[model samples]
Target: MAEDQLMTYAVGEQMNLMALLKNVTVRVAKNGKQYLDLTFEDRSGEITGKFWDASEADVERYQAGRVVRLTGKRETYQGSPQVKIVSLRLANADEPHEPGDFMIHAPMKTAEMEEELNQVIFEITNQVWNRIVRSLIAKHRDEFFSFPAAKRNHHAFEGGLAYHTLSILKLAHSVTSQYPNLNAPLLYAGAILHDLGKVTELSGPVSTQYTAQGNLIGHISLVDGEIVAACQELKLDVNSEDVVLLRHMVLAHHGLLEYGSPVRPRLLEAEVLHQLDELDASIMMMTNALDKTTPGNFGERLFAMDGRSFYRPSEGLTGKVDPEK
Candidate 1:
């Protein structure tokens, strides 16, 4: 397909295009035949695809992270957009693009995000919290900026980990201004450090998957452990009130005990961190879904949003808010 022809695909449109195989899985059908479940992504967005009756060679050839030329038709199943794969094969070596060329990334550039984050870090006034956050961030600087915040769900694109953190940090700033009694430094530290452990939890940006530690311990606990380890290494008292409060913010950001939090928010900063985290994640998920849906139609059912489908208002009120307005 020509570059000029590529655009946000519509349902039922037949297309022959090249796309990155973002994820692939093998599953057995009701007939006991194995098939490939696939997620394909281009510059625009992602859609599910299926290749039925797969052979071993087919599986080996179509692994995730490879770019492939596929003939398919856009489809809707269970209210979500997908593709009906007619044929598929690995892209030729001579093809113009690589897998990275098709990847979706954080809206802000890495350098811009880094500079903004450094400014936020400078505002963390508590010496103990400041030291721990700086030490950990410097240790995992590259991955912390590049890794996706999740394997799937909100901010699951390249550079999403840092992007999600910055979004929450922005929210924390606004919230603290409105409620001056809230500990601004504590909330800022929590927002920046809460998901940093995802760098260890997820493998990397391409073909992202949970590591064994991620599967067993999860990012919440993994980060809590890192905070304790940092305190020990930095020669700070691990049992100090400052350390405990910061750890609680990380441990309780998930808000509820049932939602993977070891404990619920016990401090004001921790509660605010949890709320900001939830707000940013929810908005990202909704924005992603709405982007995929045409105006006046409903988008896919979001599993993260309790399997709800949100409508895109025809009035096109989806642009960024102007603070001056």
Candidate 2:
């Protein structure tokens, strides 16, 4: 299908197109019959669908990470767009499209991201922090750049983990410049390494899911463990103030105990890291919703943002206020 044609079907319109099987789960209905809960994706976006009365063979054939041709109707279920699957079949061997063709990716190019990351690392003048960050990043380099920051929500795409990190670093740079008292190196290092745990937290890019460790131990604690292990391997004292502070950055990034942070942000840099992380993620979520919303309308309610919907003002409205004469 042409790029323009992707996801352009009007509600109730029937569509037959190739899409990547982003996710597939066997679900049991009240009637005691099994069905496939499916998520289909193309470059445009994703939609959920239901394939009812599925057989064992159907489950095996419609696995995630494969491209399939599906016939379905565009629909609204509880205010969200989904598909009512009429039929679905695996793509033929001769089909031109592949799973990679439908995978979403970070906006920045990999080379550009790498170069920018290296520049940020160079700014981590603290010797211990520099070595630790360099070592962990080098060790998990591929996964760090390939895994999604999450299974869903903000920055959930190929290389999203790294992209989100870089975004926070950019924000931290400006914040540190204006506040001068904030330690630039500490904030930068925290930003780079804060979500590094997500590489371990989430499975690879294709059909992303949370791993057992992610569900149980969680990313913050997992990364803190990694920092401790790295210290052991690198022969650095884990008890040192530098190591403790670095660990605290990751542990307190979620901002509160209820939100998964084991501790609150006691350090100024840790507080800044937490705030910047929230700021970047909030911006991404709101921007994504606004992109799909028509001008002068409110977008969908964002669950991550207290179930609030944002408005996209019509073009040509001056956002600036006139100064008093």
Candidate 3:
């Protein structure tokens, strides 16, 4: 019920770790190990803890996602924090709680992001592209307005899908505007439609879990199919070859097939969309990781940002005067 206090085990502190640890991960041990690997987390961030005591009762209580209380000494494993657990118990039910009590979230404004997204859709001038975009928007506007761009990796937050999609379109529209050689409509249409299926492919308000269709059909096939259907229903003369071009943007959006794209990006528009998506996503993720940093110090090592950690400059956190005052 109480706010679980963070254990500030710095680089050299004697981690009196036998304190309550919450938000831990339970991983199945590889190749028949005796114990499970538990990853515990709090707003200060996460640590890996191994629980070897394996009592049947304890196993039931500490299943993956079930919050647990723990006592352990904090230790460093290759610079990241590790916990040596001495005692463990499940968090009691009927406690005052919030989902944020466990899951981490991106530093972003969902409402503001969605509002800017509408502006991008509004900017589409092509009648055909506008028709398709508007139809997709109408079907999943609520979810698209709230869905995550991914379950993890990049842009994985509430309203993240809209934010990431809008950002990609913004960059694509801005960059291609400089290159008169590029087909503005092709690039813009591709960018706007590239990730629309993601609105339907992911679920969860606190966690961006994949939908059943995400695993079975995948976003590429889903979006491509939808584009074809929309083109047919609208009686648009979307020539088969050009539809292939639009589909290529969806299929090759990841830049390569190994990353789940069915084809590699070959066209200039496809290549640009792929790169811009990566650019926008990677920059936003790094920015999100950087924001959690404490003043005048390095941040908790971010696995999502590679092995390297971030350092927050002291003045970055300086107090500002309230203009209204």
Query: Using Cα atoms with residue i matched to residue i, what is each candidate's TM-score against the true structure?
Result: 0.94, 0.92, 0.72
lDDT (0-100) at residue 165 of candidate 3?
A: 79
> Which window of 10 residues has the lowest lDDT sum in candidate 3?
16-25
- Once fitted onto the true fold, the runs of candidate 2 whose alpha carbons sit more than 4 angstroms away are 1-5, 315-325
- What lDDT tens digits, residue by residue, belong to model 2 across residues 126-214? 99999999999999999988888888779988989999999998899899889999999989888888998888888899999889999
If the candidates were sorted by their lDDT against the true structure, best first, what order would they fall in? 1, 2, 3
Residue by residue across 1-325, what tens digits does model 3's lDDT show? 2234334664344443222233234445554545656766555545677888465565666654455566656675654457777777665566423445654444556677666656776666667776777787777777776676886557665566777777887787778779879877777778877888886676653435578998888888888888888888888776756666777878898888777888899999889989998899878766655554445767556675566677777875548888999
Best by TM-score: 1
For candidate 1, write residues 286-308 as lDDT tens digits: 98888877789898898888999
Task: Give the C-alpha miss distance for residue 194 in model 1, angstroms.
Answer: 0.4
Backbone clash count for every predicted candidate, in the order shown: 0, 0, 4
Native-to-model Cα distance after best TM-score fit, residue 86 in candidate 3, in Å: 4.6
lDDT of each: 0.89, 0.88, 0.67
Most accurate candidate by lDDT: 1
Candidate 2 residue 181 Cα shift, in angstroms, is 0.6
lDDT preference between candidates 1 and 3, better one: 1
